[model samples]
Target: MSDTRPWIYSTDHDDPDPRTPEPGHVYVQLVGGPLDGQLLDITGYTPEERAHGALLMSNHGLHGPGGRSDYEPRPGAPDRWAGAADTT
Candidate 1:
C-alpha cells in the first residue's frame, strides 16, 4: 500500500506563509491515536488556544473515521501534541 498522508507538502518546500519572524501559522506534530505523526497547522488559533488543544473530528458522518481524535500539547515538548495513546 501507498502512503496517503496529507502533510507531505507541509514544511519541506518553500513555505508560502511570509510571516517569518513570527509566522501566522504553527505546525504541531500529533503523536498518538489514529492521527499520530500528523502535522496539524493551527494558523488561526492564538498561542493560548493552541495550548488548550483540540478535539478534531476525523470523519464525522463517514465510515472509518475513528471518531473524535483528542490532542493536547505534549508536556515539555511544545512542538508535539497527542491524544490518549501509549508510546510516542
Candidate 2:
C-alpha cells in the first residue's frame, strides 16, 4: 500500500548540533507528503503522541541517523510542520 502518511525524522530542533534537542521545538520530515524536512514551531500531536515522539527521539537519537524509527501522522491531522528527507 502507498504510505501517504507523513514521516518524522527528527523532532528535536534545527540546532547546529544534531545531538541536542530544543526545549519545545520539533523537526517534522513531511506534512501530508509535502514540505519535507521543515522545522515546525509547534507539533500538531496529542499529548500522548508528543510524549511518544519524545521517546522516539530519545531512543532513536535526536535525528535517528540510522533509520531507527519512522513516525506516522495521526489520522485527520493538519499539516503544521517542516523538514526534508535526507538525500544522502
Candidate 3:
C-alpha cells in the first residue's frame, strides 16, 4: 500500500484550536523498520493528524525504493514521539 496523499506545507496562524498546535513543525522518530531513526518532518500537521502517524515511504533504506514503513505515535508523549514494536 501507498500513503500517497496530497500535502501542503502551510500552517494556519488564526486557528481556533489551542490544545493541539500553533502552526509549526514536529518530527517523529521511526523505530523498527527500514526507516529506523529517521525523523519524518510533519510541518503542516495537526495533533490529530500527528497522532495517526503514517506509513512512510522507504525510498533509500534497507527496504529500498517503493517500500512502505508503518509508524504510529507513541502515547503519552505529544511533543516528543518515538517508535516502538507495538503501541497498544
Most TM-score-accurate candidate:
1
| Cα lDDT of model 3 by residue, 14-88, tens digit | 645322432465655555555554456676677778878776555544456665556677777654444332211
lDDT of 3 at 49: 82
lDDT of 1 by residue, 1-88 (tens): 9545545213545666422324565777777666676677777778898888877655422234555666799889977887753221
TM-scores vs. true structure, each candidate: 0.60, 0.21, 0.51
The residue ranges of model 3 lying beyond 4 angstroms of the native Cα positions read: 1-24, 60-64, 79-88
The better-scoring model by TM-score among 1 and 3 is 1
Which tens-of-lDDT digit does each residue in 2-86 have in candidate 2?
6443333443356345434357665444442233443433346676664333222223333444432333544455333222232
List residue ranges in candidate 2 displaced over 4 A. 1-15, 26-28, 32-35, 43-75, 79-88
**After TM-score superposition, what is the CA distance of residue 2 in candidate 1 from its true location, in Å?**
6.6
Kindly report the root-mean-square deviation of model 3 from the true structure over all alpha carbons.
11.6
Top lDDT model: 1
**lDDT (CA) per prediction:** 0.63, 0.39, 0.53
